[model samples]
Target chain A: MELRINGLKKYYRTGKEKEVKAVDGVSLEIGKGELVSVNGPSGCGKTTLLLISGGLMNPDHGEVFLGEKNLYRISPDVRDRERVTKVGFVFQQFYLVPYINILENVLIPTIGLNSYSASVEQRARDLIDHFNLSDRIDHKPGELSTGERQRVALARALINRPSVLFADEPTGNLDDYNAEVVLKYISEFAADGGAVLLVTHDKRISRQAHRSVRMKDGRFVGDDTNPVK
Target chain B: MSLINKPGKRISIWMIIKNELVYKKFGFITGVLSLVIATSGFVGAMILLRGDTLATEQLFMEKERELRAEMLQLEDDYRIIMRNMGYNVLILNETQSISELEKEGYASTYLDYEDVWKIAESGMTTLNHLLPVLQEKIYWPEKGMEILLSGIRGQVPVYSKPAHLTDDDQYRSPIMERVPEGKADLGSEVAVPLNLRPGDIFTIRGEEFEVNRVYSRRGTRDDLSVWIPLDKAQSILNRPGKINGILALECVCSTEELGQVAREVKEVLPHAQVFEFSSLIAARADVRQRAAKLHEEILQAEMAHQMELRREKERLASVLIILLITGASVWIFVLILNNVRERKHEIGILRAIGFSRLKVLQIFLGKSALMGVVAGIIGCMTGALAGVLWSGTGLSFSGQGSLVTPPVIITGLILAPLLALTAGLLPSVLAANQDPADIIGER
Candidate 1:
């Protein structure tokens, strides 16, 4: 699916005395099946831009469009429904529901998709196997290594086969080998006709995407088509 | 699976119950305790109320029996007095007339003095002659005379004597031969002598009687005299062909036929006073006014006391039940609330996983409801067993009566759990209304 973010802006009020413009007048678009990365220093509005694109946070101004439906024009409940069906979100912390098993965690999005679907379980099993986590399906997040936990979170995001996946620092907590594994998974998801928008501070992870943009002070400062250089 | 065919709500309820089983022991215990207290209170109240009702009924019945016995004894006393006085008693006042006596070939009797003196001087043979003539006109059976005579004998003194002449050439009396020398003498006034005291020898002249025993005539100037048998009086007075005036005593009648007998006796002896046995007893005992007033007072007092006790008991039971229910509810609510508070992280996860606020509420409430129902049932069963074991065995605090088992205790047990659930509703709803986004954000 084509994703468009137009003139997005966000601000945070600090104790009623100061205002911080996290994302200011920034816009970008991604074609179907394309993987794009937003790279910046910490507190440079990269995460804010990703959050707005994934519908996890509302922008103070501007609009987000997935194909023909404008996300901001609809009620929050409707937007949430659309987001659950069409968008997948991965956070920097993995944010895995701690008490549930890995398989159950991966199956969370499918539960929202339909109350009862036999195929959803099979889909979850296949995702676990794809991520090489079949042996740890019943293990809780606390028992899993950081890399395995991130993999489980990715499986959870992809359970509904969301048209667009948004990842914010998908490998920020992992070692080089685990980060490569996570990056490979994101590239494979993009190759399988799913569009991806990733935000990261790591140049190596950013280079894996088809295109890259650099943001500074809530505005895009650079656009590079050849991200590998 | 088809969404509608799946038991989504039921499954949620099961999950709620399962969660409660895992996390809410204190809430479960409090609910059970509430059921126990409610059931026990209900059973105790039932026993007390039933016992009081039964005792009051018994008291009324016992009082009724005593009143009946006393009334029967009073009637017997009046009957004996009539017999002792040698009179035929009648109940109706207008049955006989002086003209009827004259037409029946007897001397007309009057309430005036002349006829009274003549009859007193009359002999027994003459009285016997009058009896036959009276019988022909009276058309009454001998049983009527027996009844009449029995009533007269009931009124007379137990002992009597004949009047005779003394050697002093003055009148001689069995009771007192002559008046005291300095005192005003009542020469020939008639008197009745009694040998018994109150509550003594109850029979006179072959019939039962009750003697008042004290004989002080109010405003009377008369001779002290003795009561003599009719035959002995006739012989001593030397008046064999005449009779003294007939005295009539009164008695009660349970049937109309007896009253008719009294009326017939009046028709035969016009000067005789006819009295109904019921009216005579009423008058003699002064029972109509006094008994009615006393009964009214007693009934009012009893009813008022019963009502007051019932109200007090209701107030006490209500307060106790309310306090028990409220205390149980508050404790259970607090426990459940604490449980919810501890499960805040779980709640955040569930919300993140797309569980609605309302569903979260349902799960928590469902747990409490299940506990309430189970505990209530247990309480009811225990209460019923206690009632059965203690029924009719006089396990009670009030000295008036014994306790009875009540069905309401079982009903209370059944309702206690529901009440507990209802009590938990507010807290559960509040917990459910908590924003999932905010909870997760806090974390």
Candidate 2:
């Protein structure tokens, strides 16, 4: 398994006696070359599950394993290092730094990894070319269209060649055409032996995944294999 | 559009700060402006203080020089008054009786006329202006009167005395004029009784003489006397190359006592005794000391006034500097805090992509430091220039370069950045500690 979660539970205090079960006793496993999608409506805890699994948020009771290394068992600094080197995250907002160009934006992950070399830069350029963003590499995020920004975000995610990719609503802000393009890139990442855990409410996106999991009230209701279209 | 422009360069924290500053022009510029105002105020105050000290020192020297000139003039006036009063010391034969000298108004005992030369050549510093005089009361048969006749010549110069430029004989003599070989100067009482004038012929005990000038009336013993050539009087009195007294003026010094003058004179003239008119010497010394005391009081008063003014200026500048620094610190704090608030999502995204908390802190802190560095340079130049102009020192770099010394400039340079860093610390820490999950929400 490229990424695994065992008995994960997270809660939020709503009042003195009331709490919301954001993720409760959830368990899932993803192998290399497999793209799994969590389908849920708004406020259904799918995003929370993704956040806990990506080593960004701590679960109250659970273990998150990236290639047999428990993220929660290690120190925060080590966990951060593990996440930067082995896990990549993509969000719906495409939170790009407005002042820097798209090429620098894609190379930002390499800065965290402290691994920028001629080869790393060459790979970034290749990723830009693959995402069809070579023409827009030098343009700031404000100047780029919605589709171009999402593509830039996707390229940034794949730049470090992480073992697992966690994307939350990566296509929520894009048009149908751009969403299809972004989803295609994500599928390609998994095809190249990467593990992908995508969380979204769009059922149509779930059909494109190798397996789909339906979540409600912080629990998985059904897990099924989706037919390849 | 230019892919080749950014290929070999790494994206550093400083580079990020630079780009961010360019993007947020208003915030960075306003921050820099506030820092410049504070730093310039500090630099200006320092320069102004230095200039004031220099000006005060120069003014003090000028005033002291003027006072010295005035003191010298006062001393010359006192010398003239004392000279008119007569010599303060009388060196006579050691065997002369004090009672006989007082009763006859002349020394009964006599000393060699060459004895006066011995004192002058002794290089003694205590006395100057030696005049050898011979006097006696005699009945004149031709004039049909009794008179005290005195013989005198030009004063003897003492080589050891420092030359008083005012006492130069080329300008004017400091004592009575010498009587010529065939002339005489009669006292007012004698001249009135004898009906003599400047060119009148007179006879003194069978010796004929022409009256040179009639002396003005003095209420002292000199009014009843007649001055004539020393050789003529010596011949008439049958006292050749002999003198009853040596009249000399004692040099007045603050440390010189009346007894000291007598002792110094007797050391050179062992055969002669010194008689210093104590009242006359005391009065001259008192006048000089009083003048010196007045000069000292005036100089001290001027210095105290200047110091008071400097203290007032220092107080005002200090208050102004404190206010400026406070205002700048508050402004920087607010600007950086607002910047952190506005860039929340950017920080979140950077953290989510694996940037550490320290890197985020470097981004904000680096921006603040850049602002301070640039402002420090501008503030130093403009502050020094403004200080010079405002103080009316004139903009001459050669005269005023030391006012803006290296230490002052270095402090200004270091102060601005340190202030910026100190003021921006809290906001930068807050930005660094921001949780990526809370900012970039899972939803």
Candidate 3:
């Protein structure tokens, strides 16, 4: 499904009768098999855009269309269903469940769902194996290195087979090698027909994307495609 | 290809809770111990209070029972006395008026007591005490000790054999209806100083009475004394039913009742004296009154002692309750507050990575609940053991284990977890509802 956004806006109250527009009238589109990167400085609404698109925060005014359905037009419960089954997110800090093995951390999206069976277990094992963590499947997050934890978090984000993936500074805490490895997975996920949106201050991350958008002061400043880094 | 199961999620939640509890040993121990100690105090106080209450109640009941039995025994004794005295014995004292008798709990009884007569002196005979026949002599000293015998009359019947009768002598003839009519059914072996037969007569004080029947010898006082017909004694002694004094078997009654009777008798017979025939009855009543008064004082002391115990229990309970709430609440509140503060970034990451706010709340609540379970078990056991150890049993040293009963333990088990949950609530909710963008900065 192609993800479409139109006229997105959000605001915050700094004091009585005083307000700041965090995200104001922003718009973008990403097709299946397309990975889009949004780059901006601090308070430039890059994170706010991603949050609204991922249904993590409600926008004051916006229409987000995932395929033929308008995400914001639906009930919050239905939005949650969409958020869980159709969207996956990655954060800069690997939010690994501190007590659990890597495989169990990857299975968090299935919470509150009664649809558990043998195949789900095997699928978790397979995903952990795919991440080159088969030997460390039972190792708690505390015992893992930074790179391993990021790998576990990536595996967790993709465990539910979301149609769109949102990443907010996914490699912000990583060294160059680990960062490249994380970007490569995002690129590979786009190549596998899942739409991708990556918000970051790091220009290096946005430089190599199929499309790049630049934002400033709650508005998009530049939109470029097919450009050489 | 990837899939996840619900149980897999539950296991994940369980691991998160277990992880913090095991890794952060100091926090877990501090939290648990706070709850345990407070719970133990509450449970222990309640156990002791309950035990004391039961023991005091039991003692009070026993004392009451003993008092009731004593009162009933007095009542039974009074009933028996009434039974023995024929329930209707009468006495006459001519000196008193009817209005005076009415002042007691009885009316003035107009009935008169029949007399048993005595003679002052007689010549020509020494009466044999063993002689069963009553003797009355009617003669004048100027007439040379001669007796004029009255003709035979109808016999008056009585049931009590004279106490003076010897074991071998039984009354074969009907005795007089009046009390202590000195005559008896004399035993045959009795000796008489006078020559007398069943038809013989005797006189005294210028009046005469006949010996209706001569009886067998009675080796007792009956053999030595003489008895005369009641009417003959009245005329010869110059006294009738208005005799100066008479002995009676009274209605066996309570001291209060007997006092009332004596007052009534005094009202009717102002110069007459009435009292317990045996000295022991009055003395026993006095003893009982003193004993009852002493028992009452003892009971009042016990009541005061019981009141003190109750006040102490209330005081201890209030203190324990405050201690319990403060300790448990402070422990959970500070522990969770610190934990949530430390884990803000983790919470942000979870929200960004697809875990819900509810899931975050569950993780922390589960940690506190685990603490509650341990506190419950430890608190209950310690409290129960303390209760048992404190109370001593029958001889005042070891109890029948009236210490921590079921309610105390139940309250501990139920209340411990609840306190922990309440303590953890605000911090946990704050942590759970934390925004991912705020702490982890756009995660």
Instruction: Give interface RMSD, per candidate.
Output: 6.4, 1.8, 5.0
Candidate 2 residue lDDT tens string, A1-229: 9999999999999899899998889999999999999999899898889888988888999999999899999998888889989988889999999988988888888877888887877888899999999888789999999989988998898888899999999999989999999999999999999999999999989988999999999999999897762
User: How does candidate 3 score on lDDT?
Assistant: 0.67
Instruction: Give the poorly placed runs of model 1, Cα more than 4 Å off.
Output: A39-51, A92-103, A138-147, A168-180, A200-204, A212-217, A222-229, B1-273, B276-280, B283-310, B324-353, B356-443
Q: Best-fitting candidate, measured by lDDT?
A: 2
Please tell me which predicted candidate would have the highest DockQ against the true structure: 2
Candidate 3 lDDT over A202-223, as tens digits, reads 9998766888888898899998
List each candidate's DockQ score. 0.13, 0.64, 0.28
* lDDT values, one for every candidate: 0.60, 0.86, 0.67
- Look at candidate 2 and tell me the lDDT of residue A192: 91
Candidate 2: tens digits of C-alpha lDDT, residues B1-443:
33334557786676689889999999999999999999999999998988888778778888989989988888788777777777888989999988889999999888888898888888888787788999988888887888888998878767675473145531145476788888988889899877888898977777889989888898777878889878887898899999899998777745457788677777877888988888877877887888888889989999999999999999999999999999999999999999999999999988888889988898889988998999899888888888777753643456476677889899999988988998999999999999888887634
Q: Sorted by TM-score, highest first, which candidate order results?
A: 2, 3, 1
Candidate 1 residue-wise lDDT at B354: 51
Please give the range of 10 consecutive residues that has the lowest summed lDDT in model 1 chain A: A109-118
Q: How many backbone clashes does every candidate have?
A: 31, 0, 31
Of 1 and 3, the candidate ahead on DockQ is: 3
TM-scores of all models? 0.61, 0.92, 0.71
